[model samples]
Target: MLVRVLGSAAGGGFPQWNCNCPNCDGLRRGSIRATARTQSSIAVSANGVDWLLVNASPDVLTQLRAAPALQPARAIRDSGIAAVLLMDAQIDHVTGLLMLRERSTPLPLMATPEVLSDLSDGLPLTRVLSHYCGVAPLPLALDAPQAVPGLPGVTVLALPLPSKPPPYSPFRERPRRGDNIGLLLANPQTGRRLFYAPGLGEVSDAVLATMRGCDVVLVDGTFWTEDEMIRMGLSRKAAAEMGHLPQSGAGGMIAQLDRLPSGVRKVLIHINNTNPILRDDAPERAELTAHGIEVAFDGMEIAF
Candidate 1:
């Protein structure tokens, strides 16, 4: 199986247009050793031909242009993506479907019932796409592991996480079962598994078990500390209040990850613009290296 990191930053991307935070300002001024990144998303391929796009980020267009593997060179007006599987319905995660409206065929879109409802009703992305390049919705049932259509040998199981829905969702305050989720992608043939949870707010016992069993774990790295945005006066809410687990401190992502077996390859994704891990020489980045954790970057490829 091959996993490619299309974009690794959170919703705003690094050096976000409106943000001049230290990391963003430093990178923009060429004063920091860091790589600029786009929004969070990834592509998975079982045979390196047909690919499954995990999330269709707002930066999808630019992300695809940088990924030659996602460009089906077989024919004119073609795409390598066989299907799109979404974990949630945040604007940053699903708006790119509009960009794909030019496709000659309907899009194979998969998500939980709740997520599907949001796009079909409140968000209405699916409704808009219906006019052009229609969508074929595949309900991802969390009862058990099911084969991801189009990607042979690859199976996906939905693992529910504790998280709030997007503000536009009617049930934003009343969290539901499928509102947010992680995925367990398994190659039955190779017995190599990957656990992906890009927007996780907290790591539950089930989540930990899945990580322990998987060969690789790519989890939320949205904030370096719980009060990151609060300290910077960017937002009133702390990292936990916004449905993300900070990387440091007690009961944080890093502490939880340290408990995982050493053989499991651990990586952090969905990094926010203010996160200190973006700098090459920052202590935060060095700390991750010391703990054997990698910060996901655009164009990163992992094959197992």
Candidate 2:
């Protein structure tokens, strides 16, 4: 199993434009010890040749350029992105599908029925793409594991996560079970498992079990504290309200991560720009390291 962290920052990305916040400003001026990051997304490959993108972030074009493996040079007009697995219907996660409209064949898109409905109705991305390379929607079952369409030997199980739908969704207030999900990927050849939930709000029993059984767990690290955005005056909603589990406070992400077995490789992704862990010299970074969790960076890769 080959896993790649293509981008690690949350929605607007680290050092997001239009906002001169400390982290963003300091990073731009080279006064901070942090690295620039794009919006959150990941790519996984069973054979290393045929890659499966976990989410098509708004920064997917830049991510694709950074990872040469995703642009295999078999022909002048070819791509190594075998299929796309959407975790939700959020703008950041699904907008990049437009950048992939140049593909020769209809792209295989797997997502929960709810997520597909949003793109088809609310966002109309699936409808617009009909004129382009088009999309072939596939099923992502919550009851059992389904084989990834383009990647052989790789299977993924959809676990219902505690999260809300995007604002554009008509059912935003009436959140459904399949509105949000995390993917548990298994490599049959290596018998390695990975739990990836970049938008987790709570660690349910099924999520806990998935983490325990997997060798690698890549999770949401959207906020450092529960009221991060509120404290920064960026938004009125707290982190929890936005479907993210903050890293600090009682029963927070760190506390949950601490309970995992030492053998499991734990890593954090989808970090918000306001999170202090992005600063290399920050105490928060040290704290996570001490607890055996890695802060994912763009291009970070793990092979098992």
Model 1, residue pairs in steric clash: none
Q: Residue by residue across 192-292, what tens digits does model 2's lDDT show? A: 88989999999987788779988999999999999988888899999889999999999999999888888999999999889999999999999999999
Off by over 4 Å in 2: none
Query: In model 1, which regions exceed 4 Å deviation?
Result: none
What lDDT score is found at residue 151 in candidate 2? 89
> Backbone clash tally for model 2?
0
- So what's the TM-score on candidate 2? 0.98
Q: What's the lDDT for residue 4 in model 1?
A: 97
Q: Tell me how many clashing residue pairs each candidate has.
A: 0, 0
